[model samples]
Target: MSLKGKRVIVVGGTSGIGLSTAKAFLEEGAQVVIASRSSAKLSEAKQTLGGNVETYELDFRSEENAASLFKKVGEFDHLVITAGEGAMGDFRELPVDQAQTAFNSKFWGQYMTVKAALPYLNKEGSISLTSGVYGKRPAKGASTLAAINSALEGLMRGLAVDLAPIRVNVVSPGIVDTPVYAGMPEEHRKSMFNAIASQLPVGRVAQPEDIAEAYVYLAKNGFTTGTVILIEGGALLS
Candidate 1:
């Protein structure tokens, strides 16, 4: 269970929660490799994560790329995948392409990563994927995200069985303050965050560091598999 000297690959580890999770591993004395689609972000993350962290520029959207990435990574102790494209919009107005983006990125991307990493993963090592609170409880303009996230949770269950001792689980976190909201208008984003913060029992929405710890827990726990570790800010309960 000890993470010291373990090798971990964090897909989407270039920024946000993924980056924070990577930092967590480094601090635990694990050998970390971070992969994402952005070379620039990867470089920046490497600097922020310190020189001990290794990095790879990866496009997990392609199964072949995912496989190739693991081939290069060789063997590892754990895999934490938090990279995905967010698709949110009104269901009635959604285009097929728009909806498919979420499926391709979050769901299928994680699937391919697992498939590829299995051969390289150390027996008993863990894989922690990401889901969301909205998967079980949706709101306006989140139909696509909800469906994709639900699918991911289901995928983790199946993966847990198929992968056996390798162990597979998911972390479903509530809204976190991250760059994922950068696309929103500043005032609107602030107002939305404030509103969510006010409503949550914890009095604040999650931050990347808040969610990152969950990933570490999943990695360290040997008995847990095929489970969804929900870390939402009591949004579902509220």
Candidate 2:
């Protein structure tokens, strides 16, 4: 689908899935803006994206920053939220603050972004949030992530109906080979992903580009709203 002239904002676009999505939009002739808490990363992203791209510094955990970022963004045809925080620990062992951080980043951060952008969104504009396969299929040591992602999906569906003409949707991806996993212990990370990938019908983890198409589809399809597009390589098949 052609997105020529579309004004798009991609939060957390400095790296991972968000960065790839931003590039995809730019390639489609859309003017894109990328926001992140990291100025260094944002500057690098701006240089890489080159034309018709803008970068903003935002730490979504801060209410003031979230509000200010959207205010400065003014208006846009689509807003894509791919920023999230992750924690791995048993529910009982996990610190409350750790869980809160994840919730605040993914759930509340998304809420704040959407709330602030509502006034500036075009009549036919769309909002897309990132959830994940964990939201649907829970796993050990991932309770916090699962809960937050599930909540995000529910929020998007409810908002889609409440927002009406302004479409809202969730993109739930499976294991994606992004920088987000760079911090994990190498052996454990490899084993974990290998097991996860083996279970998927496709026998492979997703790439950022694989999931980016779903976001682009949801944005262009006016008739689709309150929907969750699964980019999981059939991981949920079982």
Candidate 3:
């Protein structure tokens, strides 16, 4: 894709799919600006990505800060939001308080971000959001995630219309082996992924790089809007 000299912003770009996508954009000669809640991760990511990519500290919770950052950065070509943590639990017993807090971070944060950055976004640019297969096919204990992801997909379609010429799209990845599962024991996490992989039609889960390709397509393709590029490893098929 010819993204030469295009300015791109990656929210939650410190790690995982976001980080991988930023690298891909830079390789395509896009000027990449990365944002995340953690300053330490941002610093680490910068050192790893070299001097080409810019880093910004942004907590999605703070709309004022996000607005200020976008205003300062001026009009950029594309905005890719990969913020939010994965939340999975029984729907009935999911702690209302914590789930609500997580929801704000995951769902509402994206909405707030788009609202803040809309004024500065170039008409030719696009806003790419991250959703997942869980929205369509929830697993056991994935009730919360399924609900939130479903809502997120809805949010993307709504933003597509609201934003008009500025494209809005979502990439739905299926269980990429990212740091999001760091809370689990290493051995257990690996085994879990292995087991899940065995069940998938593709015979593997996604890598960060695999899902990153979808973002590149959405950002570079001008005709694609209100689209969900599912990068799952054929999990839904099985």
Best by lDDT: 1
lDDT of each: 0.91, 0.89, 0.89
* Candidate 1 Cα errors over 4 Å, as ranges: none
TM-score of 1: 0.98
- Worst lDDT run of 10 residues, candidate 1, spans 98-107
| Reference-based lDDT, residue 167, model 3 | 96
> Once superposed on the true structure, which residue ranges of model 2 sit more than 4 Å away at CA?
none
**Candidate 3 lDDT by residue in tens digits, 110-228:** 88888898888889999999888989999988877787788989989998998889899999999999999888999999999999999999898899999888898999999999999
- Residue by residue across 6-108, what tens digits does model 2's lDDT show? 9999999989899999998888888899999999999988888885689999988777887888789897899999987877799999999999988888899
Instruction: State which candidate, 2 or 3, has the greater TM-score.
Output: 3
1-238 per-residue lDDT for model 1 (tens digits): 8999999999999989999999999888899999998899999999999999888989998989988888888988999999998788899998989888878898899888888888889997999999898898987899889998899999899888888888899999899998899889999998999999898899898899999999999999899999999988889878
TM-score of every candidate: 0.98, 0.95, 0.97
